[model samples]
Target: MATYDAALVLLVDSSEAVLLQHRDDQGLVSPNQWSLPGGHVELGETPEQAAHRELFRETGLTTSELRALWSGPWPYEAASRIR
Candidate 1:
């Protein structure tokens, strides 16, 4: 079994609208889909680091503040590689 760690950011506006990504149709993974902003945790990086990195890389937004929500083992299958 292979274990992969990841991080996600649930960006919400003042009106409580959550920001999501409309994945590009040309992508190899979940193409043309709506999802949260995040990606896998890279080497030597914590989940929080990965989360912030992914958020900026995908949405070009930056936040100087972030509260820890949750962190634990997730029951995700790596073979399917669902983002």
Candidate 2:
């Protein structure tokens, strides 16, 4: 069993429009797909920290306010890897 930790940010504007990023077509994962601004959580970092880092790294936007929508295991099985 392998566990991969990740964090994502749901950015909403005053107009209730949400922000999303288009993944690179040649990217290794989820190529050319729309996604929230986020990435894997680094060692020694909390999910909140990773969310802030990924949001700025991907969108150049920063915010001090964040609310967690969900947290738990997301299980998936492919080949012999479980996550």
Candidate 3:
């Protein structure tokens, strides 16, 4: 059996362009590719909280309005495009 982890994909749209980050080569899933801002969901932490933390850490952007678009037990790897 494998330990599964939760994650959230952070997105921002200010009536302009969306954000995206590139994942470094890791010899796993997507490498040196593109993905949205996201990361592992913390214990006892809501998906929104996780997204809030990731968005700043990954993109250095903050917003008063935080929303979750999607989430699941997907084994996402490495840093990818943040949109």
Q: Which candidate number maximizes TM-score?
A: 2
- lDDT for model 2: 0.77
lDDT of 3 by residue, 1-83 (tens): 23334454556477767788897897243568898876767778888887878888878987778766666665443323221
User: How accurate locally is residue 73 in candidate 1, as Cα lDDT from 0 to 100?
Assistant: 49
Clashes of each: 0, 0, 11
Q: What TM-score would candidate 2 get against the native? A: 0.81
Please provide, for model 2 over 1-83, each residue's C-alpha lDDT reduced to its tens digit, 9 standing for 90 to 100.
Answer: 43467788999999999999999998544679999988767779888988999899999999999887866443323312321
Report, for every candidate in turn, its global Cα lDDT versus the true structure: 0.77, 0.77, 0.66
Over the stretch 38-79, how does candidate 1's per-residue lDDT look in tens digits? 777777988888889989999999987766587654445562
- In model 1, what are the clashing residue pairs, if there are any? none
Q: lDDT at 72 for candidate 3?
A: 63
Cα misplacement distance, residue 15 of candidate 3 (Å): 4.1
